[model samples]
Target: SSVSVVICSGDSVFLEGAYQYSAGTYFDTLTGGNNCDSIITTILTFASSDSSLTAASICFGDSMLLQGAYQTTAGSYVDSFSNAGGCDSVVTTNLTVSSQLSVQLSSDTTIVTGGSVVLVASGGASYLWSTGDTGSSVTVSPTSTTTYWVNVSDSLGCLGTGQVTVTVLPAEYLVYVPNVLSLSSVNLEHTRLYVYGRGVESLELIIYDRWGKKVYESSDASATTRSDGQCCAYGIGWDGTYKETGKPLNSAVFVYKLTGLFSNGKEFIESGNITLIK
Candidate 1:
């Protein structure tokens, strides 16, 4: 028996010639297990393989594989290969690598002149900061307005920098006292008594004689004889008199003490001398 068929180019079924395969109709003859003659016909088809594409993204120092080779650089590549289906294949590869470097830092901040603040830095592999800190965050207290810088590095050896500023304001709890007093002797208008401080919550003024006896003491909710610019727009003082006696205190050198609480709830203490002159 005979068979006929149309085969494409470059294909064959017989082990006949130097060509691996060619498009043609072929026949094979073999003896079966029963020693009987068996005839078989085969048809083959072949065509050029299509061009292929591959993409890649690799880390800094890693290699990009293209064209059956490891390439350290990034670029377009092409390679020819023989497909298992007996076709010539052309592959086109476009590769990319990760080499970007970036860093982030927290924004500017303001704090009380004596307060502290925390600085935040990004997730860099390593860091160096101007405040001598090497961690991702640090605590700082700047006496005045200060700017801090940080140097950061990634695993790929790329470096980036970030900066932040901290501003310091004047303290709210400020205290001031005069060194001398006329003790109501200069004039009736000069007898105004007050203790001067800023942002004070409550105040206590105590006067002591030479023997440490508490001769005069005034307390919270002090009255502002005149605005001497104390906390709460109020003032604190004693009227040159004794606490135990209604008589005016003698004109002499006397010790005075001032104790108060700041607006932020901190304690304040101060002591000084005032010369009570006639």
Candidate 2:
């Protein structure tokens, strides 16, 4: 025999020899309230489950992969997953993104003294140089070696600083001395020979007659220090005259000794014969 009964959705009922009962009717043998053999039935029902979660934050211009798919736009996404109940569960994800920050400066460079070079900054909304300027590029001419720094701010208000060193090369040295000078007429003071070069520290020239007698000498030629700190550059020189009376020397071949010091601490000594015209 069969009996009918109502049950809530997803609920299960039992039969005589079965544990699971579907939406169909079942028969069971039991001692009804009358203590006699009777039949009863049960039915079962089930429902689906789902869930939602927020995804972690990610940087701008970067993508996130979910369930073998890539996504960049910020929004809600859904994918099916197997739950412990052996059912397909729907999972929703909400994504959040942020902006990226970057900053950089030009590489280091080498320059000679009195020479200038341009430095550039990049990957920023604004820039400020250590030299008190605000711009994307700056020109620097340092007497000696120096390092310059630039502070950069990104669109997201992120700040970064970078530096580049500028190495300065020493000044060049060059000089020229005349082999002969006239001491008579218009050549009096014009005959004076001053050290000449791009960087002359100090120079001293002495004159002597054929007899080896010192005819002219100026300052301490051996002094390590020069009043003018440049190489091949000095205003002091010999006027082709005697040391005592400032008298012009006679027209003759005279032996001269020259000692020069350079700004770089290098020294040179030269001795040669110079002709004097009377």
Candidate 3:
């Protein structure tokens, strides 16, 4: 009698009277019902199994799919399944979880109108700004108060977000008036009372006597030449003289009113006292 059998690796099968553990032809002697010694032949074959090893990594806070389960930590995993040859296919995986990626955005800032500021981001492999710029740093010139956002990405494709706010101050003009005018001074500049400042578009300065009578008045809104040759908006200030008669007035404290329109279309009115020292 002859028989053929197939078994998985590391498995055994009983053939004839003895056990067979490997793939090969075997001969055994068995006693039949007639009490005579009979010879039996067995042909054994093995279905090969497979094994494999792999390595994988993922960012922190993220999960990796290993076999039929998801892994979140670093470790070794094993899985087994039947292969096409009806044998066990074992797979071993070594997973590594990386640390978290952090990102820091620049601090908030203040800037005047039409001014620009530089924003920065750190601890990221790449950066993108709300202004459609891509880099570690970006320059922004916002006309009004605005909030900016940034998105940072790490090498592993992890993403982080941060925000910053910029406060924009409007363009403004300043005015400085003299409280005393030295009419008899040797310096001709000090003899005249002039308004000092910048951004003034139009100005009207009027001086009144103690009896509330209009004395000196002027409409000069031209800017004064600075020491560095830069021109700053200023108007010819009050002089110790009477407007009706081009004559010097006596030394006395007088009331002055100043009104003007700024280059930004803002209006201002100021009242103060000035002393004339002849």
Quick one: best lDDT, which candidate?
3
Stronger candidate by lDDT (1 vs 3): 3
Query: Model 2, 154: alpha-carbon shift in Å?
Result: 80
**Which tens-of-lDDT digit does each residue in 1-278 have in candidate 2?**
54555443345555557555356655677887889987655433444455667666555677788665888777777787766655567777787766555567777665557889999999888899999889999999999889999888776555677898876656574434566766554634336644445554667767789999999875432322223554433455667678847786778888877777656776655567777775
> lDDT values of the candidates?
0.69, 0.67, 0.82
- Using TM-score as the yardstick, the better of models 2 and 3 is 3
Clashes of each: 5, 10, 2
Candidate 1 lDDT over residue span 1-278, tens digit each: 45544332445444333343666555677789999988766554456466788886665567866778897777888988777655667788887766755678987765667889899899589889997889989999998989999998877555778999886656765554566767545564345356665666787878789889988777654434334343432453556777746578778888888787767776666687877765
lDDT score at residue 15, model 1, on the 0-100 scale: 34
- Model 1 segments more than 4 A misplaced: 1-171, 184-189, 223-236
The local distance difference test score of model 3 is 0.82
Candidate 3 lDDT by residue in tens digits, 211-264: 999997877898887445555636655567788366889999999888887788
Q: In TM-score terms, which candidate is top? A: 3
Residue 197 CA displacement from its true place in model 2, Å: 2.7
